[model samples]
Target chain A: MTGSPPAPASLPGDDLLNRIRALRDSPAATDTGLGRELGAVADPLLLHEAGRLLKGVAAARLTRAPATRATTLRVAVAATFTADDVVPLLRAALLAGGVDAELHLCPYDQLGVQLTDPASALAEFAPEVTLCLMDAGALLPRDWDPSALDGVRTAVRDRVDAHTAAAAGFAARTGSAVLLHTVPLPRPDRRSVISFRGGAALGRIWREANIALLAAGETRDGVYTVDLEALFADEPGPVRDERQYRFGRMAWTPAAQLAYAREAAAFCRAVSGLGRKVLVLDLDNTLWGGVLGDDGPAGIELGTVYPGDCYTDLQRRALALRRQGVLLAVCSKNERALVEETLAGHPDMVLRPDDFVAVVADWQRKDLHVAALAEELALGLDAFVFADDSPFECGMVAGSLPQVDVVALDGDPACHSTRLLEPARFAQLGVTATDAERTALYRGRRERHRLSTTHETAEEYLRALGIHVTVGPADAYTLPRLVQLEQRTNQFNMTGRAHGEALTRRLAGDPGHLVLAVEVTDRFGGEGVVGGVWLDRGPDRWTVRNLVLSCRVLGRGVERAVLQYVADTARAAGAAVLEARFRPTARNAPAATLYPSAGLTRAEGPAGDDETVRHEARLDRLPTLTPDWITLVAKEAPAHV
Target chain B: MSDTMTTLRPLVARVSHHPAESLAPDTRFTALGSWGSLAAMRLLAAVEQTYGVQLDLRAYMKLETVGELASEISTRLSGGAETHAG
Candidate 1:
């Protein structure tokens, strides 16, 4: 079937509305195609019209291909003011971000009670995400001491603390990730005698309160702070609409709400671990200014100057991402020696050759090089984000490798850094110690590869590495990496469940559950928390809920060791039978034979039943072949668990 | 100079989902049968954003026809006296 026709740019509001309605009514209009058609429109009015029309499209009637995974996210908004319009905008934004969102907007002025009360709709709804949209006027006390700055600061901090506690409490109860908004600083009133002093005092208090809010958000897992204050400050359009505020208690203008919705959608996407991973950057004018072959190393526009500083700034930003564990790869069509010389000798270059996990400096097509990098790194093509200054290269990669996110740079060099940062392609909810040590971990892979090449056999290579595996219950230190593994590990995943931090924590703390995090360290370096297994502990049988290992640690016999440890632990804990189930996905074919190979007998299934294969390992007759290459260090389960 | 009718007619037409040529100066928003609350708010935001004039809620409520809205917008834009049609 053909895709829906794209709506014309100059179509009148009514015509556009009719077109959108027609698209929705058409049986052949796929959800993806319709979403794309709606998203392509640049004008707000046309987009709004399309959104309004699509709202009428029956949820059941919206047809999608089986391959297209649709995540139904239940989102609750607890705000001080009316969100009737904002809710729709947010829903549209979420749709644009590739999720079908079901929004529940709490009653106005009931944000405090609804969040704190366990019996509130928020609890019953059990939303995946809750947005606490608040205003400064509502949060701060009206009768605080104006003259005494310290008293005001203390009072503000107290109020912020109470609010944070309420939000954290709600998140804990519902397992929903809480997104708290930092209250925007009030606009300074000009009539007061000590206007400067008063503004200063208010700013100080608000700043302190915002900082406290961030700290509180950090302490609680799955709680993220959206800097609404900065969002409003950065907004170019009208932020506050007094008329709407007076009429309907609307805190922000429609334009500002639209912008907020976009930001909120990005945040939600990041929380779901849908953000891009690898940043495949081009050299020459992309990373540095000017062409490498023509300009040479010294002639290139880099260092502390006008256009040169811009390129330097871009490199600094890229380096920041590298530090945050984003794998960097160089895909450039240039003389390899010149590029190496530039990276090695360029005094202004912030990124060194060692930073890149994969370097493709040959005269190959960028698309081919990127695919090769993905293969070399064992990451899905969807995880890569291709960035280059040349529009031709960006377009080429984007057209050929549709999975790779292309950050197309054009115009001035000064705006390149801003443009790269603007899309927030690599936005993640939280960074763990494992994330910070990702570059080094990948570097260790190179060492492992070298050892493999030197050794005659796989067993010899494995035995020479001196691998140590530590198995323990998921703790605070290991929770983030465990969650990351759950989100990103596609190939070695058993169930392919992307369990968030809160759910993982709950599972770890539950007595009937065993959430084991496996940390692997070789003679080279420590690959932090490379695998995780969630199991249900029964009286006489243990069921493996999930078994996931990072693709980086695959083929090292670590999976076997992890399974053996689980079998041993379960047997010791009075379990006669240990069972595992593998739900095969397109990416997880590698894990198809894992359970069977580990000596688990596969049970016969009824004809035309689910593809999920159930395997059972009798604890009484468990396999005793322990590989001498790896030493197992099992820690006692936490007392709380 | 041309009155605010020239600037206001197109916006009113856009919000009311009518041709600018079809809109008369005396055309009542109620007579158009399409100027709902949402349309009214859209018009208000468009006017505020386009012309940098913050229309008073009281004045907006009292406005009946396109002519009256134009006059009110003119008064606000020129910093003239307020007019309460009610």
Candidate 2:
């Protein structure tokens, strides 16, 4: 079947094809179409080709063909007549962000009656994502006797509560998420109509009711609430009679309502785990005003007024991604030295050569440039996206690859970079200890890779670096960083397991378990706590519960030092067998080969089931404990630093 | 070593918003930190009016240091601006 139709004001050209080729070539390539267009490249044909190539690459990566086509969410929506146009607009936003949702229109029919039966209807639907168009009247109920008004008040309130609660429960049960849209409460004094009873009445009750529903759902563990009141405070409003509905007092204008819905829909998609990973960028007309070969660095258009100011802002934003732990690499078609000089010497260019983790700025096919980037960065091909102003290049990548995510932006170039905030490309995990050292660390890795090419064998390259590895018991300061590493490191991670703050505290408190953090330092610099090991001791056995090594330190002989520490320490503690496990992942081939090389015997011990490869090594007979490259150093807690 | 230079310094070095030059004498204490709490307060009747965030007297007083006050004000201002833009 065909892919979902593109969103409104559809971007020009195909995005999926270029992304696929970029991904096939390199999982690390980012879609640069938007940034390049915004960066102001003038050649439309180049823009067309670049965008097409990007789309092809993106499509190939995403064609995983799930056995059962992923279910589209059943969304029950409710909104005021004033916000009638919002649902479809939101749907477009959600679809554009890759959320599979089918709207079940439950538009508000004068509010009170529509909300009364929400629970039974919502529970019957059992939606993966639930959106409550909350307002004040539904939340803050009127003080009326439940027995008198035919039980309407209590029934309405309870149903709204149950609907929200059920949605949250479904999310927590099915691993889906629920969101509540809380409309801003109309300011009371501004909209209050004077009654003969001498009290001025405002329409804020509708907004308050929504918040009450949100609060009721929040009391339970699963439901998450969004504060729309905070979102629409300064939004423009539709033209309304000042005497009716409190006019200027309303927080949102019709235009603002549309904007708010679009933004909310994007957020829902992001939090739901469907986001873009890579952001391929271009050089020459894209990175700066003129071509790098022609502009001669100092004469380039970046870092000045209007168009130049835009690139500066974009660079500043790219740098912020480091804090979020997004790896950045270069895929510009330019002379490597010229691009390097512009990055370093141009005062206007905020991004330096060190900012990108890998560079593929050669005259070869764009498809090949992306492929090399993936190998260098060690990311999956499907996770790539390419953006370029050149549609031809985009089409080339798309036709060549077909699984990468390619976004070929159309319209004004200045606003292209800002669109990078689209919800579909969100990565959920927060920053880890590895994030702070990313740019410099990746730059160091790239240097090592470049240096390795000159040597004949991999061992010769490894021996050249004066590498030192230190392994010891994790203490107060080290535990926080270790926990952070466990939560973020993907490749070389045993099970892709993650831990939170509470779990970190518990790990430190458990005396039976030992947490070891390994420090690696090479010729370039000191890589702080690049490896972590969690060991659980039970009588005569020591089990390795969690083991992860940063990709930055992989193949550097740090893994051996870590295991040796465990074996010797276990022997000292009087434990017998040291069992190490190997779990396979698409990006962890290096780790799958680790166990066999460590001299542990693999056994197939099960019938009626596929045998998991397990390694058994007796701690007592483990070789004469000599930490060849590692020297056990008693370092103070990192906190004191 | 020069008594004349030392005594006339404060009168000569009064700073302004100009980029590291053209500072006037008696240009006010804003030289330490620009658009600070005191200056913000002077600009508007209350913190609630000048800033998007409502400020209690205790909250205002906690900004004892000039730089801290500037940072607090800057954070609130930026947050307010972001909420408005959103």
Candidate 3:
């Protein structure tokens, strides 16, 4: 049985472990069986056991399964205790989340030393994410008077300041995202009765410290606080095992560690652009309690009633997601008029038809409808999440389009909202203003698509749409979207290089580099900043380091406009040669001949390296190429600069 | 074979990579070809989890055969409530 525990009669006690070890060692373990076995392990101790054994198996490289499409996340841990004790749990959690983790555990109580020193193991390891694990006890002063509230407050402030400064310094020095664990509140002791009566209690001090840490994360880039207090509060079992803590300095229980690791992996996935982007829902018994066609508007259970409130609450949850830039879509087996009427006329419906970027209400298969929606949104099938209450529909879509994350909504209606929000599939590290405006942008694209079909020729349609392109240097306001584009754009990117926020900031500020963001608008609406390009200027030559454009604006000649702007800028800067490189990737086949197509001469730079095709055009002989139908506006430089 | 032996035999056989029929109650873990430290830890965790008992660390370290491990689990199950895991 896949992902099911072996029958108790067949594998009892020691037999279960032996079977797991054998399965782990056998060739079949990695081939579709490991996930099942791991899923079957319901007991935390057994899970830990499986994790420990799997670590060795992973190290030995005995399993024959193909490697998952995963990023090898390098993580450095600096804690006040033996934090490496939970590394196995963390690895198991990361594996569960479809990520491979490489951990570097620094010496205990050496967080400051490792973070401050440039040549420390932490810096040398060059982790992409650094975790600073500290407990409340570490920050609390020893032998402090309980009545001295001001003194305790001052001490807490000092500790907070020191921790924030260390985290900021680490991020600046190593270019690593800092994940700070909020200090957990201490367990009740002899002072509990008095401390509970006073405002300046130990718990109060801990709370203030956590708030300060959270504020620190908000004020800095690539720094975030993981809420250990909230994690512990939600955990059903003991948050801390006193025995383990006293024996080996293990701060939290295995369950808590597992939860923390899952959160950390989610954060890492978000940072790496692996999180899901779309939420595709089914209508009948999915978004509402009943079918729109059969139940009709009044008969449908979707208001503030017992069963109706469940569906109503689900709709509100979906609306919340939409507000946070998660694109909503509908794929249901219903007539278009019925779906529209229910969405528009249903009294309990929190989501209107406008909330969804695409509504596929037809008799087509759910998988086909989802695929069409992905195409319409210009996103990969993996980016879509299909949720339906029907088991058959969920199974069909799951089997047909395995890339889509299928949430089979079963069980009581009361639990639907919780189920929908439980998976961290759509977790995001940070949401920019552009993210909030994504649904509107997609809506504008739909309008443009409709307008494109009215004209006979592409040029005629482009002229009729009144397209406008603005080319400008990247600034603080546009940097996030530019970095997001750099990280996420795969299909039309010339070189699939993910220049993160730190590098993008450096390039934008450096005089030797030129980074430009392209914003597109048409008569229908603005598509926001849809593309970006980065150029590294040498002494005599300007090389296009990266050029990425969103697929949403692909057919509208935005790529040509951006490329022409780059060439014009290079020619104006007195550069002798303008060069570009096209590094081919699996998804970047659309960009393979981009440089050559733009009239740049294809040339071989070095012998024996054929992966990157180099193309160059002499600035003196370059021809200016611009689209006549669209208006191009060059943004003026800031007056201060 | 006893019920405990029937239940423990498959686990031992699987871990030791021997035939299930080859295992007996007195089969020592040290004699098992694949019974290394890692395997032993895995065995300890699985047995504890499956039986809902926490074997004492000292007693666990002293275990050598299938019967000894099973006896330890039985004793723990009868003596006290299931121990909380960390």
Candidate 4:
């Protein structure tokens, strides 16, 4: 949970400790990894320990990762107490959120001086953003009598006005954005009087002071706030360490400090203008309980039952995010007809067809769909977040499209909304009506892809491979490579059996099955036994049980020889027909067309959704040939090994 | 060394920039060359968090050695709750 607990608090993990130890004292290297690990931390003691470990490292030395390329922001921190303790935590949190901050902590207990004095160190730093923190304990009178509400209000106004004016003056002088948070009410003062009358007066007066500061600071030219008062109501814990306060005027408790630091980092992110815009959601388990294909439109779990409510909850949350101006899009694999049918007709579905900016429910790989979505919207992949229930899809997007933020909507459907939204992936200071009109504001960023051509030209890089292909029987040397390809090969695989080593070994001796290992060698090096074909021999027809090719050799255009060899072997052995199962799993679309492209056609009637479609060809009509660019060498295993 | 001393020594070392093993029970906090107001405040903050003990800053400063600091932790760990952590 992003909110601080009553969470199980423990010391920092050994992994974090090891990373801290391995960190070099180099000025150039960014502490991005350290920031990532610390970002997951919520417990005050653990974060404090991490800060203590990172105490010696100067904030300047630990710049955020250069991957984001956000320009370094000069931030000045002015607080009521000694703020040295806050810098490490703030730096870690800022770096975690991908904001590269160069922080300057104003002199201890000089919140007003730093804001007003032109010759002060804070003014010299020339900050882009100034984080101004206040303690209620420092602001409110110690002896706030229940009778003197007006007097306490005057004193609070007098103390707050001085700093607010100084802050406005500073922003006017330097065009620097000033950030302030509503100061929390001190516990001593809150408990100092217990009657209903006393409590009511204090609560009323305290809120007035907080609102007064908000009024003065935010309405000014370039000032914003991280609302601590609202944050406390959401995740309430002790706000002050009275002992620390008594000793050094350090009022914030560990959780309070962390919450403030995290929100402060969010402000920094908003200032740096790094936020996700498009949320690419997947169907099946993510939007409903079960696979849509298996359950059918009416059969899938939705708003009426146990786990279905969870999906509804997530859908409701998605609509809420859309209201905040985060565009929603769906990227899923299904017959587009069924997807549209369900969206239009489903009784429990909170989202409708019109809610999404685009719906790409097709058989193509989703990474391509997401990229096309971005290009269509004229934004960068960095601005997109792809969330899916399947780890395969998540892994695919994360590996190929590293710029996109991928969220796995696996595990309990109940926590799906929290998991998707928790990173503050779409953090913005506040959304105004003006922002809705400013859609062109995002189209303006040019660090984007034409993704339409990324894949079509990917094979262009392979032209220099000087490719060669070799097909041999599956045997001792080639068995390991063949087994790996059978388990891992997906797009080019006829059947997704994901066969293991034992199954491959057992099938090798079964005479009824024939396994051929295909290897590719390029100018660079041999790619081992990177392709494999498994066949089952029957009296009437020989079935190609699985024809799998490794991605390493996909673009080399050698699969024709592989298919031709199998057809000839079956035909020579007196088999009249050659056939293979073609299942259109969202993933297997690329494989389904492999046989049709090589002169095979679908057998007869329409295939059921669950049943496999059979593609067959007369053995005599074979017309597959290896391309001129590839030289094929066929080998046979020794008789009976 | 006492359990409190075992827990307190490393934290003291952190603030003072001295090795934990080098700072014995009798090593005076003020005697350390690095001991200053900032270090003292840091040590107190760490001490309060580690032991769940809320110590009087004035009284804590009056103590001379690491042993005395550890003893204060032991006393507070047993009884006394001016403002202990939950």
Q: Chain A TM-score for each candidate, in the given order?
A: 0.86, 0.61, 0.88, 0.63
> lDDT per residue, candidate 3, B24-77, as tens digits?
567788888867754565465456545666666556778888877767666677
State the displacement of the C-alpha of residue B73, model 2, in Å, after optimal TM-score superposition: 54
Best by DockQ: 3
Candidate 4 chain A, which ten residues in sequence have the lowest lDDT sum?
A: A440-449
Q: After superposition, how far is residue A449 of candidate 3 from its true place, in Å?
A: 3.8
Taking the tens digit of each residue's C-alpha lDDT, what string does model 3 give over A489-554?
A: 878888776666766777778889988999999887898888998889886899888899988888
- Please, what is the whole-model Cα lDDT of each candidate in the order they appear? 0.75, 0.53, 0.73, 0.72
Compared with the true structure, what per-residue lDDT tens digits does model 4 show for residues A220-283?
Answer: 5456766788887666557776766776677776567778888887777665546677789999
Q: Chain B, candidate 2: TM?
A: 0.32
Supply DockQ values for each candidate.
0.16, 0.01, 0.22, 0.10
lDDT, candidate 1, at A341? 82
Query: Number of clashes in every candidate structure?
Result: 0, 98, 3, 0
What's the CA error at residue A511 for candidate 1, in Å? Answer: 4.5
After superposing candidate 1, which stretches have Cα over 4 Å from the reference? A1-23, A30-50, A54-70, A142-155, A188-195, A444-469, A509-512, A521-526, A554-557, A579-617, A621-641, B1-39, B64-86
Clashing pairs in 4: none
For each candidate in turn, the interface RMSD (Å) is: 11.6, 27.5, 8.4, 11.4
Give the runs in model 4 whose Cα sits over 4 Å from its true position. Answer: A1-11, A26-33, A43-67, A216-218, A234-236, A304-306, A432-434, A437-641, B3-59, B62-86
